[model samples]
Each structure stands twice: as structure tokens, then as C-alpha cells.
Target: MISRRAASPKRSTPRLPHLAGSAFRSRSASPLALNVMTIITRFLSLAVLTLHCVAFAAGCTADETSTTTTLSTSSSADASESTKESRVLRHAVFFSFKESSSPEEIDAVAKAFEQLPSKIDSIVDFDWGVNNSPEGLDDGFTHCFLLSFADEAGRAEYLPHPAHKEFGDTLRPHMEDVFVIDYWGDANEVTDAKSDDETELKHAVFFKFKDDASEEDVAKVEQAFAELPNKIDSITDFEWGTNNSPEKHDDGFTHCFMVTFADEAGRETYLPHPDHEAFVELLKPVLDKARVLDFTTK
Candidate 1:
């Protein structure tokens, strides 16, 4: 759980924030206290991963784009241009990290990144993560994440902010490899916001499991997600599934699950829940290469 509000300064030896919030704020780490090194690390992670997703999707064959155009009829490239104009994907950075990263290391990395992740103005939804796995594949990157905003300008504002750049400077040396991609969230895509009593805090967690898992594995995972909504008092919504990305975009990810809450406060409530605890126990056996990204988005 990361949020902002602090002085601008670097520590001779940086320490990441340990949190405890109001559901959203871990009771431990409240609003914020600057940890320059952590911010730099998250920024670097964000940019490198962002580029990775774009690079991966950029592989979609132009021929596929052409083939999708009605084979029934098409005279020139002009008609294709028109279709391309009608659909554009808003891009976000997704990073996959080494599987062996310790919880302390991951938490340390997440903590240093204490910047405000907002869904303000213009167009899309924004998010970021730690990878979960049942082992085997690791091309060095495994922590998949999502980034969204109102529109391109909103993202542009985020790209070169002092906070972002500082992160890039710090993370380059320690990183092994990274990937990023971009996509759009259509304004037409309708999602019903939960009612008022639920508005004070809102959060979503998205994760996908390995594609080759058995049916039983998936069922176990769903049970885990389902039990989360019940085990925690604050959860208002919970859903799970396999991803429906255009086979072209899904790479290594397959099964997906998401849970939403009024805010971080309610979200934190689940962290220590017993069902969530038991589910965690059940999960280790059936899950594979799982990825988790938690964020505040509407």
C-alpha cells in the first residue's frame, strides 16, 4: 500500500515504510514520509516494465491487422487507416521480476515507491506488483502489473515527473530484465461502481495463473478468491477467471482474479484474515506463475 505526502530529501541510508492503514492505510505506514531511494526504484521498475509490454504487443503481425480487414472487400490502405483510428489502446507498464525476490526485498521495493497513484482527469485506470508462482519459467521477469489513466496526456504527465525520473536513476543497476506493454480501456466499457456506503475507499487486485494448470487447480484458486470476499468484512466485490485477452496479447498469463473494496482500509483487513490464510495454504499447491497487482482505481 503506497500513498504520498512528505518532505523532499534523501536519506544517507534509505528505509522503506512499513504500513498499517485505515483499511487503505496500513496501521503502520500512514500518509507518507519520504524515502527517496524507494521512489527511484519503483519509477525505474515502472518505466522498464512499461516498455516491455509495448515491445511484446508490438509483435502482433501487421499482416494480422490486414487479415482482420474483411477479406470480402477492401480496395486501398485508406480504409485500414480509418479502422485503426477508431481503436487505440491506452498503454501501461507491466514488469516481471525474479521469482526468488524475498518478501523483505519486494516490500522494500514497494515501500520506497511512495508516490500517489491517481485516476484523475482525461481517460484510463492505473495500477502496478509482485509475482506469484508455482515454479519453472522465469525469463528473469515475472511480476506482471497494470497502468491506466484518463488518457495519454495524463500518462504523459506521469512519465517525466521528478518522482518517475528519480526512480529510473536508482533501479537500473539492480534489475536483471524487464518488459512493458500498452492497451486502451474503452470509455464504452461499462462497470457499475459500488454504492455509497462503499465509496470511502476503493481498491482492486488482479492476478493471473499459469495456463497449463489442471481444472482442480483452477477450482482451488477460485475458491481462494471467493473465500476472500467472505473471510474479510471489508470486501464488497470479488471475481475470478481466466483472461480473455486477444490470444495475441496474453503471452504467459491465463487465469485471472480480482477483488474490490471501498479503499485501502478495507483492503488491509483481508491481509490477515483466517480464510485468506487458509486459502494461501491451499493456493501454494495448485497455482503457477501467479502475478498480483493491487491499486486504487475507479
Candidate 2:
């Protein structure tokens, strides 16, 4: 009786949906729906990888730009520091007022001259004082002004400046004579001498060599003068150079020697020192005119 119904048609079970070669099977999804979801997941992963690569590349570029800028800034600072350390141009000016100029007028002229440094940008250093040399070799020059510049360009700019031109106008009527000498010198020479607590006395000497003097004679004189600092204990600092001014105001002076002393006693001892006298003996024959100006720095 049970085998009798077995002849009826047999039925097969339905298969679950799954991706090709996948172990997982889903009962709720169709094959077409699973294919779409797999495609979307793969595309999202690729998109995330692309975003990470772009962010990394941008970071590298930013770092490189920052490094280059830092290097450029460092180089400029080093060059500026080196220039400040090496040397500076010196502008030494001396003035003598006319006999007709009263003290008040002379003082006004000096005040006006002093203000130019503030008004002119190229004047780096400034100092001035009245002559107090007991040696009486000033050649009627009563006032001395010392100014400094970084280089020739700075001086060039200062020379034609409106402030300097105005100052010249104020000085012309009262000025009897003007002497200017420009030279390049070590930056630390004057600064080191001035660092001391004692008051400084500057002995500035200018000489116009005789027309007949030989170059060898001039060299000997320069060497002998240079040796005075080594021989004389009273000389605090010493420097010398030939005039290189563009203004043609040296008044026939060629060589300028600057000697610094700590006090009046130091200068007094230096003036009559045996070594100085010996140098003077060597200098007199070749020297045509010597102008000496001594002042206590203010």
C-alpha cells in the first residue's frame, strides 16, 4: 500500500543565493542583489586608498617648501652678521670758524651739524667735540666731528642728502675752513678702545708729504709712526690710512693717523715720549704740512 504512491513525481529543494566561489550563503538576498553589493564594497575600498595617497603627497610638498624658506632666511642673516663684524667706512670732518663768527653763531652751527645724523639715515655713528690740544698744531681748526658708514654707498647717499645740504647752508656763512678725510678701517679698533671706562682722548694727525719726498721715504715714515704704538705704553689705540675721500676736501693732506689715549696724562706722556720724538725726527724732512687735532670724546 505505501509503495503504491511512490510513483508520483518527485520535487527538488531551492538553492540559496551566494557569490561565485564564496563559502557564505544568504537566504534573504537574490543573486543579482549580492552582485551589486559586492561591486559597491570594492569601489568604496579603492576610493579610500586613493584619498590616503593624495593626503600623503600633499604633506610631503608642504614640508619641502617650509625647509627651503628656512634655509634662505638663515643665509641672509649670516651675511648681514659678517658685514657688521668686518669693517666700516670712516668720515672724519674738521671745522674752523671765521674770525667774524661769534661764539653763539658757532654753537648754532655745531648744533645744526649734530642734527643731521638724526635726519640722515646713512649716518651710523656720530661724535663731536671742541679741540683741546696743548700742542698748538691744529692749524686754526677748533671743532672735530667723526661719523661712520657701512660702505661707500652709504656715504654717497649721505653726501647729497637734503639734510646734509641744509646743514652745509647753515655752516657756510660761519665756516672759515673745512677739512674732510675718509678711510676704511677695522670696525673693532675704535670700539675696543672706547669700551674702557676712562675718558678717551683722540689725537688725529694729518700730513701732506713734500712734493720731492720719495715713495720710500713715505713708507719709512708710515712704518715709524706705526711702530710708536708698540714702543709707547701711553698709546691706547692706533690706526692709520691714506685719504680716499671723493669730495676733494682733504686740503692736500694724504695720510691720516688716529691715536687714542685714556686721559690727558696719557697724551702728555705720548707727545714727549722718546719713541714719538724719534718718529717726529724721521717725519719732519718729508712732511710739507702737518695738522694735529686732539679732543676728548663727548
Candidate 3:
């Protein structure tokens, strides 16, 4: 992490005391004895200086070690703060009810899901709606729900919460096909039903690659997908990311891409564009299963 404050310099070693030669001199002693006394005093002073140097070096090492530990701790804390500020975990769910299920039953399931955030504290945001796309590409899925968490830990808490399990029980009997994709990305802050009161069309596409697909093959698909906006003119906004949730709820889908259109006319132009057709062919060889959910903001 980048530090806002400047680093301080290391403290300097202190000076040793000066030794006086006159203290070692004995005026009453003979020349040889006086010479011996002077030598012994000089040796003892040199030893004291050596010991001081060693102790000073050790102190410097200790200071250096302490500073390093402090900086490491500061960086870790800053990184935690950055993660908190920049990212959010998104839980994307799509459900297709069985033929035997009644309208009242589906409504109950939806209401039960809406009430989950009240029981599970980890869910920070929730949104749900019925499908409203004309493309007929949703693979039988009719309802969609999006749940947001502040971080992965919050998501972790939400998945196993009793409320979530209860909601699952409500959904299981009527569920036909379920597709889930959770990932970390920028938090959604679009609270308005429509942008400027005009219905906005959203194209949510989920992809599951073949088990044998190489990393290179996946990269190629990603590159081709990203190039669609430039190849087609109707795409107003686009974003893509990989799954990161640990809930095991993804059901083999690993990548999600969302494209926003200003209106249904924009989406119609994109569906049959030559570039898009070509991109689909590129995805076919390594693609395992794919699902799409297109909806207009209510």
C-alpha cells in the first residue's frame, strides 16, 4: 500500500567517552612499571570502545527490525481499507419455474427472497424482477434476482444463513432450471427504474467453458467479446468479469458479461449483427453451456 507519510531516518549511534592518558600514569613507579601500567590502561580503554561499538550496532539492528514490522502492519491495514472501498460481491440468480407451479407460488418465492436481507445481515442490497426481453433467449428462465454484499466474507455469511436455506426450500419444488453466477465488481448504484424515464434494456449473458478448453481459448473468447461494442453501434455500456464467490452456487457458469442498450431497437440491431454472429462461432468450439437473461428496467 502507498503511504501518505514520509519515512524517518534511522537514529545515529552515540559517541564513546574519551579516555585520559594522565590517569594511567604513576609518577612514583620505576620506568618499566610505569610503561606496563600505561599499556594495560590503553588495552582496557580499547576494549571498552569495542564493546560500545558492538552494543550500538545491536541497537541499530533492533530499531531496523521494529520499523520493518510496523511498515508491514501499516501496509496490510491499508490494503484492507482499499478492498473495502473499491469492490463488492454480486450474487446473480436466474430461476425458471416448473410447469406445475402456480403464479401464487412464484409470487411467494419472490416475496420470501425479498425478506431474506432482513433476516440475513450480510446482504447489503437486493433487486428482483420478471423477464421482459423480446429476444426469446432466456432458456426458460423468467425471474431474476441480484443480491449484493460488501465483501466476500459477507457473501459467505449469507449463503449459509438460515434464511437463505429457508428461501431455498421455498424455491426447490417449483424450480425447473437454476443458473447462478457470482462475481466481484464495482458496486451497482443505479437506483432509478429507468435512466431519464426511458426504459433501458440489459443483456445479461453467462458462459460455461468446456472442461478441455485451454486458457488460451478462453482468452480468445474474452478478447472477441470485448471487441463487440466497437464492431456494433448500439451498445451503450458493457462490463464483464469472472466468478469469485465461494458458495458453490455458480452451477458451472464461470464468466458473465452485461451489455446495456438505450432501447429495444438498439438491442435488435445487436442481435443479428455480422460481427456478433462471427463471435458466436468463435465461442462454439469451447463453449459448454450458455444462458442469457435480457430485461428492461421497470
Off by over 4 Å in 1: 1-212, 247-251
Q: For residue 265, what is the lDDT in candidate 2?
A: 95
- C-alpha lDDT of all candidate models, in order: 0.51, 0.87, 0.82
| Candidate 3, residue 7: lDDT | 64
| Clashing pairs in model 3, backbone N/Cα/C closer than 3 A | none
Q: Taking the tens digit of each residue's C-alpha lDDT, what string does model 3 give over 1-298?
A: 3463336565678754344455344454567877888799899999999999999999999999999999999999999898767667778888989889999999999899889889998887776778877757687899988788888789878888888899989989999987778876555443323344566677888899999999999999999999999989999877688987565767778999878888889989998999999999999999998878887754
Query: How much is 210 displaced in model 2, in angstroms?
Result: 1.3
* Model 1 lDDT tens row, 1-298: 2344345464577665554432334443444433544586789999999999887777666656767674534645667666544433344334444556665665455544434353223334333444332233334454444544544565667666776667655554445555443444333222444343433332323344555668878776776677776568887665444443332444455544556566667756766777777887877765565444454432
TM-scores vs. true structure, each candidate? 0.36, 0.69, 0.68
- Report, for all candidates in order, the number of backbone clashes: 49, 0, 0
lDDT of candidate 2 at residue 203, scale 0 to 100: 93
Q: What global local distance difference test value does model 3 have?
A: 0.82
Model 1: lDDT of residue 24:
37
Q: Give the 10-residue window scoring lowest on summed lDDT in candidate 1.
A: 197-206
